[model samples]
Target: MERPYWVSLTSGYDRNEVLTDLMRQYGDDVWNFAFFLTRRFDAADDICQEVFIMAFKGLYSFRGESSVKSWLLTIARNKSLNYLKSAFIRKVTLLDKVIPRERASPSAEAVMFDRLESAELWDHVMQLPRKLKEVIILDYHYGMAIKEIAAMLQLSEGTVKSRMFRAKQRMSELLKEEREYGI
Candidate 1:
């Protein structure tokens, strides 16, 4: 009988084995979520690496309070937000040194977004108050269910749903303005 390739590849694996397997299985989806959130390939890569590092380090604390995917997503979201904040601070610090002008035009590949429009959509998303941005990113960008989002964000499901409704409505208006303005 043939052994499973994974069995041969690693030895004495425990529950941590499940994490490695899940990473292999859902890596692309997770990275895509990070990419949409960060709007930069390099930032997504960094966030994904950090997520895995965290998952590995914190594996011993797993309490099964939430699904692994949800837990991982919460980590990813926090990391991405931190990165954005750090980047924003750096930009602010350097604002005087850099020319204040429009950002460089997008590369041809950057113009192609699988969802909504360009990464500029995230600019509008960032413009939203934190509560709205959190809900929108969890529901729309991460494809999390309202119940899951409520659990993750510690809000009631009804609140999650309502916030999601308002987020989509506001996002619709923002997107329309973006299109009209060609931004």
Candidate 2:
């Protein structure tokens, strides 16, 4: 197969070319990950933009220790978690659940249906704690290897494996319970 566009352009490229390549290549993965972490479409949109903007601003400082994707994900993860923790967002999130937003045209129903299809297990995966959920997503959803997940989460390989095991076990139990009790 031919080498990808960004592979040749990894070094000594103009900022726009490099940034554009990175965004074009990894934009969906980063956005999906942000959405996985936050479960909010609007937050994912903001976090995706912030991830690329932060990547562009810090491009020069990138040491290439891990893959560029890993670095971008680390940034995305932090920004998403920070957004979740902000006091304003906490209140807004509560209000959002309690009070419905204005009924706009249903422009995003397609995206919602696609996401809901994956949660067809009745959102059992979504019920996993964030750490467990993220490992499952990175492993099963994104197909990252355990080593990569460990590095991204700053955990040891053993820890990543254990979490994966726990996530799988919990997911199985959740599914089993649902089947047995229709919960």
Candidate 3:
């Protein structure tokens, strides 16, 4: 895909306008990838903010070797890893909070979600190893090509393809096991 027009502007682009444009175009992708990596809703927000700030500041240095979205993802991945390693994060994270809190009653959206057969697959997807999970999310959830994923994750194309294969196999096994044992 061609780079965004903003990337080509040599001058006269207002800083806010460039930042706004980046957020408008790729904000959801960045946020979702952050959420996938960190697995904490709160951490994802912080990571996304940091990702955009860094992206905007470093936009000039962006070498165009990868898509801007992948570049943002690399930033998100770094921020997420830093967050995960922080002492505050370690102190604040606990098993109880990591387990999602249930609402007092289901909302319409939740009720509708309950009817989807594939919803449970997401839970299984979460159980995969981090490497496998990352590949699955980037490839399927974000619709990233193998080359994009490899670039984002700094893996070889063959490695990315292998992880994708293993991730799907593991998901199938998880579902089969759940059906057999009623997990």
Candidate 4:
């Protein structure tokens, strides 16, 4: 069977159809990258929305110099960084304290072992400096090649590898500390 018309980028697809397909293909990866950068759920949502808008508006200019996924992530990374620099974000500090961390039901804890371990690992990942954290997330979580991450972040391949090494070492130390303290 032939592929759907919208699925083939070579076809002269309408803007809306192309945009929709791009969103479906890249949305989760974009959102997760944004969330890692922003460290806040609401900001991730806003960044992801803005990314698609930018993608839609800039679609015609896309040169296909990289994969669409990489191009979309570059847009996402730029939007996320812009968000971090906004004055409104700088002045606001309410989300962390306002959001409750605990579950109402005890049943949640019953399944917590696996989830908690994963959560703790991510929490440590979050605590790393932004440079280190981004490397770790892109390299490990997103499974991108070091070369791709270097291009996406505009760093040298050696720099990306060095950052990844430091991130892993730091994470190991953090996990060891957690275990020693019985956290």
Residue-wise C-alpha lDDT for candidate 3, range 66-87, written one tens digit per residue? 7777888889988988898888
Question: How does each model score on lDDT?
Answer: 0.72, 0.82, 0.80, 0.80
**What does candidate 2's lDDT look like per residue over 38-96, in tens digits?**
97878888999999999888777777666777788899999999998899998998999
User: Which candidate model has the greater TM-score, 2 or 4?
Assistant: 2
Tell me the lDDT of candidate 1. Answer: 0.72
Ranking by TM-score: 2, 3, 4, 1
Clashing pairs in 1: none
Stretches > 4 Å off in candidate 2? 1-12, 102-118
Residue 159 Cα positional deviation in candidate 3, in Å, after optimal superposition:
1.3
Best by TM-score: 2
Model 4 lDDT at residue 127: 96
The weakest ten consecutive residues by lDDT in model 4 span 1-10
TM-score of each: 0.64, 0.86, 0.84, 0.82
Better of 2 and 4 by lDDT: 2
Give per-model CA RMSD: 6.3, 2.9, 3.3, 4.8
